[model samples]
Target chain A: MEVAAFYGFSALAILAALFILFSKNLIYGAFALLLAFLGIAALFVLAGADFLGVAQIMIYVGGILVLLMFGIMLTQRASQQDGPSRHNRVEVPITRRLWGFAIGIGIVGVLAKIIFSANFRMSGDAVSRKSTIKTIGVELMTSHLLPFEIAAILLLVALIGAAYLALNRNPAQ
Target chain B: MSAISIYHYLIVAAILFATGLAVAITKRHFVGILLGIELMLNAVNLNLVAFSRYDSDRLSGQLFALFVMVVAAAEVTVALAIVLRVYGHFKTVDPDKLDELKR
Candidate 1:
């Protein structure tokens, strides 16, 4: 049963990702990315990282996706003559498209070969079924305290920097 | 009938990462590139979570993945603000059009 669920969610993620790659409409790609994020979150739960799964949803889906949508909407040109669908379309040259496609396929082939040949003889026990929130919380406060605090500082800097950058620096354009 | 193993998760991550790389490379718009980058970050986090499944003792993988998420969030916010600024100054978001760096 769990195996089936894993395959289902992984397939959902892969398919959604491919959809984003093929879709020319930026809005469509963003929406498909939302599906991909949900699928990954489900995989996190299936892999026994329950807390990570929840956080993934809240951060990636709730926070990041919304920010991306705003960026897309805010950056669009006001030229409505080309229709709504074409307004946000990305025109990639044929050669660049070929190169990107080849690179993507090559990387997938190399990584798959490496993964399949790896003799991963794990020394630890199999995945524990317990909720990871407690372990994560405890670790964040104890051994990983410094990095946790550093991440907090990093976020504060980002908030201030973004606000400052968005402000109008020059009055006369 | 074996269960879902690390290999399965790794394969999914590889595919997602590759697709994201392609998106980042081929997209001309700044926001489109950022979308691709977000996909790549998620793929890496998925891989980390899969490995952490085995090492349940310390969970260093999950901890690192959380930090990665935090960094990605910060990156996206700052990137969008920059994208907005560029669009305002240049009247175009295409990276190719902006040839003069100090115009």
Candidate 2:
């Protein structure tokens, strides 16, 4: 069951990413990215990082994906002419091999085989699996307090900067 | 041996990262680049969370991944704002077409 779930979600992630790569339509690609994020979140859960998985769904799928879709829609061509040219096609020709992606997978596979077998675990040190929310909350309030504050500041700054940047439209107005 | 290991996770991450790289490289639109970057970041997070299993007690990896998620969120807001501003200025989002510095 664990193995099946692992491979299934893994495949979901990879395929969603590939769909985003191949799909020329920006809107469709963004939706595909949603799938990819979900798959990643599931993988996190399967790995026993329960809290992180839920956070992944809330943040990436909820916040970032929406922002991406907005970006795609806001920048669309308003020209009256209707044709394939206006369908949000990317630079990739249909015949493109996606070799870079293939190469990346190949390289990582080779390295994993040669440099790191990643088979053995510290049997004695293996911790019992449990809900990570308490641990995460405790850590966030304790040792991670400083970085937590910093991240809050970063989000505030980003929010203000984005709002300010996007406020003004036509210079003539 | 367990049905799944760190090796499986690593392979998945690799494929994701590679696909992201390809997406970034092949896609001409600026937003496509952003999409690619997002994928690559997610791939890295997967790696971190997977290895984080080793330190499940400390949850060092998960915390790191959390920080990464925070950064990614901040990044996307700023990037999309910039993209919107650029679209307003250049009237096009194609990176290749926007060759000149000034209109």
Candidate 3:
């Protein structure tokens, strides 16, 4: 049952990613990204990172996706052309696509071989499986305290920078 | 049936990372490339969590994943803001066409 769920969610995530890649309309790609985010969250849960799973859904699905859709809508030109030219701008040149695929495939092949051949120490005991949330929380508050505080400061600075850059549309300002 | 191994998660992450790389490189629109970046970040997070689960007894991997998620959010926020500014000036987010910087 666990294995089935893992495969199912992994397939969903990959399919959504492919849809995002192939779709001409940016809107469709954004929506597909939502699905991909959800699928990854499910994968996180399956990996026993329950807290991270919820955080993924909340931050990615709830927050970042909304921002992406808004950006898409805001930047849409009000042109009245009926052809696919508007959407086709998202497509890459054929030569670039071919090169991209070649590189992508080669990298995947190499990484897959390395990963599959390597020996990973595994704890197959079900009894040892536990939620990592508490452990993460304790570590974050103690040993990882400095980085945790730094991340908060980074978020604050980013928030301010985004607001300043977005609100001041005029370059002269 | 064998339990889902760490290798399974690693393989999935590898696939996602590859697709993300392709998307990032090939997509003309800046937002599409941003989406690809997000996918790659997720792949890294998956690997981290999987390794934390299998290799380490501590929650270091999960902790690192959380930090990655925070950074990714910040990155997307700033990136989208820049994209909006670019659209305002160039009236387009297609990276190939934003060649004013080249001159």
Candidate 4:
């Protein structure tokens, strides 16, 4: 049962990622990313990182994906609106497409071979355990405190920078 | 049957990372590239979480994954804002056309 669930979610995530990469329409890709993120979150849960999985859903699916969709919708050219489906189509040069496939396949083959052959020492208690939310919270407040505070500050700075960069006021004015 | 190992998670992460690389390389849109980058970051997070779960006693991997998510969020925010700026200045977001910095 667990294995089946894992396969289901992983397949969903992988297929959605494929769509995100291969789809021509930007909006369609963005929508596909939603499913991909959800699948990853599920995988996180299956891996016993329950808190991180929820955080993934909240932060990624809730915040970042919305931001991406807005960016895609706003940046389209005027000429793009004349066509229905072609408006946000990706225009990859033929040479670049061939090169991308070659590099991608090569990396995947190498990495898969390495992964299949590598020996990983396993913790027997990893999967059967639950209540990871408490462990994560305790760790965040204790050993990970400094980095947690720093991440908060980093987020604030990024928020301010994003607002400044996206401002539309004319500098001459 | 044996239980799922770190190898399974690692394989998924590898596939995801490779796909992100492909998307980053082949896509013309700046936002598409950003999405690719997000995919790559998620793959790294998956590896971190998996290793933390399977190999370590502490929750260090999950902690690092949380940090990675925070960083990825910041990156996407700043990157999208820059993409918007690029569109405002050049009137187009095509990376190839925004070769003004080259010359």
Best by lDDT: 1
lDDT over C-alpha atoms for residue B14 of model 2: 81
Off by over 4 Å in 2: A93-128, B101-103
Best by DockQ: 1
Please, what are the lDDT tens digits per residue for candidate 3 over residues A1-173? 88889999999999998888777778888899899999999998888888999999999999999998888887777673577666424767999899879888998999999997888665543222666767787788889999999999999999999999888657586
Candidate 3 lDDT score relative to the true structure: 0.86
Residue-by-residue lDDT tens digits, candidate 2, A20-86: 9878788889999999999999999988899999999999999999999888888888883498666
Query: TM-score of the candidate numbered 4?
Result: 0.95
Taking all chains together, the TM-score of candidate 3 against the true structure is: 0.92
What are the candidates' C-alpha RMSDs?
Answer: 1.7, 2.7, 2.4, 1.8
DockQ of each: 0.77, 0.64, 0.65, 0.70
The clash count for each model shown is 0, 0, 0, 0
Model 1: how far residue B53 lies from native, Å = 0.6
Candidate 3, B1-103: lDDT as tens digits: 2388778899999989988888888888888898889999999999998877653346778889999999999999999999999989888778898777799
lDDT by residue (tens digit), candidate 2, B1-103 = 3457777888788878878888887788889999999999999999898788877667888999999999999999999999999999989888878878676
**Which runs of model 3 end up more than 4 angstroms from their true locations?**
A83-89, A122-128, A171-173, B55-57
lDDT of 4 by residue, A1-173 (tens): 88999899999999999998889888898999899999999999888888899999999999999999999988988765765766888888999889989988899999999887877656455653756877778888998889999999999999999999999876876
Report the alpha-carbon TM-score of model 1 versus the true structure: 0.96
User: Per-residue lDDT for B32 in model 2?
Assistant: 92
Candidate 2 chain A lDDT trough over 10 residues, lowest sum = A119-128
